[model samples]
Target: MQFENTLSFAKSLDLKDELSDYRSQFHFPKVNNKPVVYFTGNSLGLQPKRTKKFVDEIMADWGDLAVEGHFHASKPWWDYHERLAEPLSHIVGAKKEEVCVMNTLTVNLHLLMVSFYRPTSKRFKILCEEKAFPSDQYMLQSQVRHHGFEPSEALVEVAKRDGEHYWRTEDILAKIEEIGDKLALVLIGGVNYYNGQVFDMQTITRAGKAVGANVGWDLAHAAGNIELELHEWEVDFAAWCSYKYMNSGPGNASGIFVHERHLKNDKLQRFEGWWGTKKDTRFLMKPEFESTHTADSWQLSNPPVLSLAPYLASLEMFDEVGMEKLIKKQKLIVAYLEFVLREIDKETEGSFEIITPADRGCQLSVFLHGQGRKLFDYLMENGVITDWREPNVIRLAPAPFYCSFEDMYRFGQILKSGIER
Candidate 1:
């Protein structure tokens, strides 16, 4: 379909949209009197209107019954995170038992490393994409250092070909094969945070396994945003924060996946804790940690009920819409967004350059080559909520659940005005 940079065309697309009604479900910030055009769901999602009800229920339970809420509350705080496993598994494409909600993203990565990142005398190197999210870069560096190896010696970064913005799948696989026996683990951000490129997870996992290296992904921008088959991909483990496309609150709980093959394996070493023990035996205060024979084995502490409340609220919506429908809408909406950017780029004398590749999710990281910080400031003042990086790049992520065609159209107009004026 040829897109026209007109309100009528955008409205026509919106009228035919099945997911458009979801826009009303979230609470958006207002500028003047109108709701801001929110494209920063990649950073933090808008609050769901239903989120308050879920949180209030937990607050009420705590008020009515202090310690007893663990067993007596409507949802029961003790088993609260369990309810999320089934619903969240649908979002990330994992079996219910293979997925678990736990600590923050980097923390979970460190914990999962205990099991998957075991380095030996021969295989001590870890391979990751160049310029991974700083937290992940730091995590890998610290892990390798803890094992008594210099990061320069143990960390192998696959830099992109000289001028390319995205990492080529062949380059990554070739690097994996080249690393060979020295490679202990292959961990990368599934959807790159900087360029919005979706890595070929299945193929990469295969190559890593063929090389006898454990494979994992930091799905911070992948889960709930892309089509993931973690279990079928035979992924050793994966972890994702819930705030981005998942629409959970800021710094909320993180979801994790550990393949079923490892669930029953007791020989693997991991950081064990109280909540990770068998559910029946959990309250008994047993001295020895007994595996629940599930991903719960990686859990270190009790579920944070207050934080999990918002996450579970957001996940209830995911369960209702399902990732299948979400992805269906994402493909069309993201394409439309890309089309709008191209149309605007032509109108503005090619001031915009999209760095995000075709294999992106909801985000489009555009380099404003001919534009500058003033334009970014204008966008902020004009109620277009977007994420900005240094060197004049704006990461616009129109989450399918709330973002509409009209938002894209309006953004194009705002962008044109920002460029010309």
Candidate 2:
């Protein structure tokens, strides 16, 4: 399993890669007339070539049938969002009835919080990771304020230890225990957007539930990048955006998972609408709200078909490839990327500290010591599409669906040269 910083070695890996051929299925952007080495799938995935066909079908349906397209189109627009549930359930490891496509990531999180984040005099605090994504930070703050509590009093943050880039599992579990009866909810990003760390969700969920708290995950970065068993893990609820790693278009619709136990519960509080009514009687327009008896009950309105069209296209690929094969390639490819980064660091006498820990997915967040923004610009100008965070960390996420081992090799060459320059 030794890796070499050589083109031949990289090509050898590609020759043996079963997923290599799938790379051509996507459309990569060109820089200098060459397809760029894409490392931003954790930010926005490369578009699938098949996406145009899916989108075209929708456009054609709307043109040919107009309003009747809702019932007569190839995939029937009225129940269009339902088509996503089964395949998406497989990706997130949930039952079909427990998952559904709906609003965007933060919107779904807020809706889910309305149901899961019931605070009382005894149990009123929510525990989340410190420095969560800005959207998540805003969502939690607003939710707490809406419930008539100060964020300083109701939000409990588990911060990384001094000099640490990743969160410790023991610290999180201990924090849950410390919160004990006061903990109302534990919602965190399943894969940290900053460091690319995949938290021990199962362990953390168990600890949260044991402490009488509801546990959930924002899987925006975890959903397609890593293996998840949300159902088996007993996660109360979860949500994820489809753009990153999922290869849906930018800012596409999101998917949600509400545990089966909560599916038909009468006590759960959610903002509901007619689309969430049971399908058999939905057109009847009854005054009372009847739950769809699934995660679809969380929908506030009919889906935006244009956005869902691209997502449905992406899920088709996931159904074809399955998560098992994707994760198999992900592990090998990310390991090779780490090796290449180390090799470059040694060759250029550059101090590259990978902040992403062993518990990571496709992303490798490296702290580029003694280097500045010029190195990032050099790589970007040279056709390596990566992401730069504040400070000195650059997130390189070589999505296994399209990226080959040679990308790792070439990126190393770019890094070495950028440092030497």
Largest lDDT belongs to which candidate?
2
lDDT of 1 at 8: 96
TM-score per model over all chains:
0.99, 0.99
1-421, model 1: which lDDT tens digit per residue? 7877789999999998888888999999988788999999989999999999999999999999999999999999999999999998888889999999999999999999999998999999999999899999999999999999999999999999988888899999999999999999999999999889999999999999998999999999998999999999999999999999988899999999999999999999999999999999898998888999999989989999999999998899998898888888888888988898899888878897899988889889999886788899899899899988987889999899999999999988998899988
Question: lDDT for every model?
Answer: 0.92, 0.94
RMSD of each: 0.8, 0.7
Candidate 2 segments whose C-alpha is farther than 4 A from its true place: none
Q: Please report the TM-score between candidate 1 and the true structure.
A: 0.99
| Pairs in clash, predicted candidate 2 | none
lDDT accuracy of residue 271 in candidate 1: 95
